[model samples]
Target: MINKVQILSVTLPGNLDAYIRIANLWPMLSIEEEKSLTQRLRYNSDLDAAKKLILSHLRFVIHISRNYSGYGLPQADLIQEGNIGLMKAVRRFNPEIGVRLVSFAVHWIKSEIHEYVLRNWRIVKVATTKSQRKLFFNLRKTKKRLGWFNEEEIKIVAKELGVSSKDVREMESRMAAQDVTFNPLPEEDFVDGKNNNTIQYLQDKTSNFACRVEKDNWEEHATNKLSNALLGLDKRSRDIIYARWLDKNQKNTLQTIANNYGISAERVRQLEKNAMKKLRIAIEA
Candidate 1:
């Protein structure tokens, strides 16, 4: 068996030929050998056993990472990410589970590669939420043809995936979209002298320094006035306002506040309305 240093010396190759040559060095492990090594690592924390387990699986990582080549990322990077997942799987593997390590590790391997693709595939993130991520990965596999899905096809996919048709359409659009550089090169000029790049045209005018300063000053003044008005209120009214609005995590409903104060919900509502009126008057004054 190859030692840890020998295994570490092996570098991921740029071309297929070199990769194949390096992969040939690490032989696959037999079932008995694999079980023994895993058991040693699990019971004794044997570093050598863990090293052998990981080394034997490096070729498998290469094989799995190749499936993600369509994402336009470097194959070496994908394999590197998959190797991380493989090591994690090795650490968590149970020899008594009656499953081959490869069978269990495949999920971990693909997940790392998938995360890498999602993170680096586009300049802007295509999928942020759990449902969006599910839609993003499954959309390609579910498509019958190469082109965009038609209206009927979209509905079928939406129903099958338990998401809205609008969400399906949005994910399809995102999948079809390509990343564009935020700033264009100097030579990439339009027919007119003005640059046509998004950076030049898409800037938010309201985000200018002077405008931001003016907005901040107005907010500060309003906040100061509100604070003074709250101080002028009676204790009960102040507490009600705090519980209902000002407390970030504990905004109480009218019924809850009423229960606490031994009053009806309607009475609480009336007091809240009256307090708000007083606040408006105080701020205006």
Candidate 2:
């Protein structure tokens, strides 16, 4: 007979079709089961309980990930980020809070996916502020399907989203702007050109092999030094630094980290500042 506690692992596949099939294969837990498992994980920190919770919710992650498919990112990557959010949700779940796991997990899950999409949707970042991010994922879709918004329509969108018409117009301009590609490849995509001619036209003596090699070596050494400096700091300092700067378009808020670590946001800020100073000194040396 199988034990009362279930221990199923989620092995996501590169073939999204198979992944969906396997994800949906994990039977969703009933309300009672969800409540009980959350209790076990919360009260006892039971690893099996956590595993069971994560497996049961894999299908939810897949479903939510589908909503982001239009971003033209790999489906597997979106699902993986959703899985991370689900795991975090599971870690902090509270059955006593009187809400289902899925309800609580949705915010965390979307937060992760949103960061991933914003960071990757363009070579140059398209969304930096809150309103811009809102328009990028929400209003931009409307523009894609319906074409440009009229003045009246822009006002309507602004009212609905609680922003100024000027904000919407600015986003419209940004969306319409064409991206410029820097560092165009030399001759690889050319229809007809001599290799030496292409190289001569595209690169100067300053772009010689020696300079390129030195640049790459210096970058690698600097990265290693930064890594070592981060390792020297305590875990909290490392986490704060990554969340604030290293992780571009970070979704982790200062208040959220402070709450998680049971400290003040001011304290978190000070820690981040000190950590950055240490890193700068280490890197400069």
What would the per-residue lDDT of candidate 1 be over residues 78-136, giving only the tens digit for each residue? 98888888877888899999999999999899888888988998889998898998898
Q: Please give, for residues 239-269, the per-residue lDDT of candidate 2 as tens digits.
A: 8888777886766888988998999999998
- What residue pairs are clashing in model 1? none
lDDT of each: 0.85, 0.82
- Model 2 quality (TM-score): 0.61
Error of 2 at 284 (Å): 40
Give the poorly placed runs of model 1, Cα more than 4 Å off: 1-16, 144-146, 191-194, 205-285
Query: Runs in model 2 with CA error above 4 Å?
Result: 1-11, 188-285
- In candidate 2, what residue range of length 10 has the lowest lDDT sum? 1-10
